[model samples]
Target chain A: MILHHLYILGITVEAITGALKAGTKKMDVFGVIIIACATAIGGGNIRDVLLGNHPISWVGHPEYIVITTCAALITILLSPFMKYFHRVFLVLDALGLVTFTIIGVRMTLALGHGFIVASIMGVITGVSGGVIRDVLCRDIPLVFQKEVYAGVSIVSAWLFLILHAQGLPEISVILITLGTGFSLRLLAIYYNLEVPKFNYTQMD
Target chain B: MILHHLYILGITVEAITGALKAGTKKMDVFGVIIIACATAIGGGNIRDVLLGNHPISWVGHPEYIVITTCAALITILLSPFMKYFHRVFLVLDALGLVTFTIIGVRMTLALGHGFIVASIMGVITGVSGGVIRDVLCRDIPLVFQKEVYAGVSIVSAWLFLILHAQGLPEISVILITLGTGFSLRLLAIYYNLEVPKFNYTQMD
Candidate 1:
């Protein structure tokens, strides 16, 4: 139940971020709403589609579309003051990332997938929305280019699996995974941590 | 059954195109294969996903992946001679587009969807692989920017629907759709037809 609410929060924050990106490209309102919704739900949609799961999350719950659309409109209205909330947005986004990862891991595991698939699904759920948004906005995906974003998701997923294997209470697993993932993401940002680059420009 | 064979040809041509694009970006062999598979099957994968269809095509028939992978590898070896085959590739690509569109429409109608959804799925299956390819290559989608690509898919889909509605035999509908779609695409190229651009740069 708590996970469900956090999922909503995650999508809302993601939508705002997507709307901001679309604004950078000066997309019309329709484009903004589309991008916002894609960033909000695209990850889970991709995950479930690849996993052969039916009735993708947004399809089953149209309310999520409403939430993302509202979030996009609100972001547009508040764009002038967005700089002031940059840090706050980042924190919220971090929270959303971990929440998404946890949910992805749980969902995949519930489907009887093994750890590898669950971890991949978790990372997919956590970052692929941003990937989709960046692709639509014509930017190289940030997840592929910078930061510990996917790394945080992988760690969170593994931690959840290990903790659950130890027969820990579900709530403890959730809280601990969320706290750890969130803190790790924040610390990475604070220290400007990044995965090493793989620059290949030679003719191949 | 003939559609099944055309589907294979479509993916092969699409894979070669994707591999060539990856080569331009100096992507490694693995990247080439990934792009190839994506270009070959990504459109149908996306359509089925959005439509809530299960066991996405490539998942159910993993041989498609193998076919695309081989196509990518062969493309790399044949890159030096690719210029000589430019026109041939375009013709094959046109065939692929119509084949994919027909398959998309039939699949959606089989699932009990209306013309609108079927048409949309047809376009998605016909062109979205290119969109996904361009996005991964970090270029704005060609379908959204230039040419009569998506429009051709839309026409083919609608044509299939209309002819089928006339109580035509399945084979006749498929042939007519393919021939018209293919001819129209070639004519668009010959005439240099293009959709009007949407250039919005004003600050809002």
Candidate 2:
């Protein structure tokens, strides 16, 4: 439960970073907070609605809003140190990817979905927030490109499921999943790994 | 049934527009096609998923993809007519809004949800495609802004419900709802009608 709260906090941080980097405009406090909140919890909101969970996660827990608001404020105040923003964004994104993937898989599994569905949910939850953020910013989503971004989350989800099946402890499964996702993402970024392009030429 | 097919066709056209606008340097043909498809059917997709309809509207109908692909090809070929793009976008957007609002309300009614839920669903459906388009483009959703945008759909939905309750014929209800939304949206755009902004000074 404490870890869950930490995970949410990490998401708020990520949202702040994403909101700051998304546009060239100097967004006012309200706009910053709104973008941060949308980036942090937008995916979960969509996921909950799709799963028929009423009241939605953010509606039920307004603390998420408070946290996101605070994070956005802090980021806005510290906007001068924009040079470090990229590094911060990368780290926070990796954290968000791991945490959301775990949460998504757990939620789907709890709802009695199969492994394939749960894995898909993991990827969706992990990347959908960034996708939403990019859309709101009026830019193309990085995921729509050939990035190996979502692939890491998919692999982590499968690893978590496999670990669970092997009778590993819940904490072990989560740690492994998080570690795997973070490492894979970091490596992908370092190596500039990307997915292969679709064979558009073959279509004709 | 004809309306449904028209709605699908409008989505295809909108998707193609989005693809052409998305730019070839930033995204390949496949990426453009995917973004366009998402923009076209994204609103209805969210509405159906939220309403807990199985299989999803687009997934259940593969013809949507064929239409979207053909539209993308045409839009790409006709990319030179940049002056007419905005005008085309406005007309297509209006059509999409009216059609999706009706679909949302009708679907909600079919699912036995109350008028309130149905109206909310109508607003959701009407605004969702733009939201998806904004998100795909990485911009703040027009729905979240202080626009007269979604409010028109909400009002039209309630009007449709009230007319239905008054024992109006089905065809009349549909026409009235569509006309109300179409006219209201055009008028709003013409006059630049906007939603009232929340005064921050009034808050504690």
Candidate 3:
């Protein structure tokens, strides 16, 4: 529970940074805050909807919106320090990815879905938020482009499933899954790794 | 059934226009076609997912992709004539809006949801594709800001629901709903109508 709150806080921070990076002066504060909230919770919302969860996760808990609003204000104020912010953003993004993937898989499994369905849900929950944010901001989604993004989430989900199947403790399974995702993402970034693009000519 | 086929053909046209408008020289024909299909089918995808329908509408009928692919090729080849294509795009967009809204309401009712849910779903389906298209093009959604776009869908949805409740036949309900949406949208554009923005007070 404590970890979940902290994870959500980190999401708020990332969402704020994303909003500041995407905002124009023409947009009002409400618009900026809404965008920040969407960036923070959009992926999870889509996942929940797909899973047939009603009221939505964030809609049921308005704290997420309040946190994102505060974060957005701070981000706008700290815009001058952006040079030092990228690393922080990257770390938080990785954290968000792991947290969302774990939660997604767990939620779907609890809903009686099998491993394959849970894994797909995990990936969707992990990456759909960033996709929504990018789409709203009018940019190519990093997951769909040159990044080892969705791959990390998928691997993490598989690891969690395998661990669960092996009768590992739930806490250990979660920790290991998160660690695997974080390490894989960090290594990919360090090595500038990317997913192979589909070859059109090969299809022809 | 005839109307359904016409609706599919209209979707094909929109997919082609969307691909041409995406204008990403780096993206190959396959990528362009995938995007076009996504733009065309994304709204219905959201609707079905929300309603907990599996396999998705487009996934069940893979021929949608083929149609969209052909549309993309036509758009790409005729790119030079796109400047004068706005009128045709407008017509197709209106048709898409009406068709999608009718389908949305029909599906929602089939799911046994109430009138309000059905109407909301109608508006969501009607506007979601254009929203997807704009996002892929990296532009602020035109539906979010300009014109009485979604509003027309909403009104038409209400009209359909009211008439249906009064024991109107299915075909009459659909035709009236489409006519209402299309005419209202065209009139809104001709008259340069816009949704009123929320007025927020400064928090000193």
In the order shown, the candidates' DockQ scores are 0.14, 0.13, 0.10
TM-score of 2: 0.60
Give the best candidate by lDDT.
Answer: 1
TM-score of 1: 0.62
Maximum-DockQ candidate: 1
Candidate 3 per-residue C-alpha lDDT over B1-57 given as tens digits, one digit per residue, 9 for 90 to 100: 746975786688679656765554234443455467667877887888877876566
Docking verdict class for candidate 3: incorrect
Q: Write the per-residue lDDT of candidate 3 for residues A42-122, one digit (tens) a residue.
A: 878877776667788878987887888788777777777866877877877887888888888898889877776677678
Candidate 1 wrong stretches, greater than 4 Å: A195-204, B1-45, B52-130, B142-204
> Which stretches in model 2 have alpha-carbon errors above 4 Å?
A1-6, A165-167, A198-204, B1-44, B49-109, B112-204
Candidate 2 lDDT, tens digit per residue, B1-204?
656775875686667656754554355454566567667777777878877785566445656756776777666666666446665566666766777788789889999999999988988887777677666656567766744777877877888899989999888898888888878877777777888866567656
- lDDT, candidate 1, equals 0.87
Q: Once model 3 is optimally superposed onto the true structure by TM-score, how far is the C-alpha of residue A98 displaced, in angstroms?
A: 1.6
Clashes of 1: 0
Q: Which prediction has the highest TM-score against the true structure? A: 1
C-alpha positional error of residue A69 in candidate 2 after TM-score superposition, expressed in Å: 1.2
TM-score of each: 0.62, 0.60, 0.59
**Chain A alone, TM-score for each of the models?**
0.97, 0.89, 0.90
Which digits, one per residue and each the tens of the lDDT, describe model 2 over residues A117-158?
576567667777877776666656776574466677767888
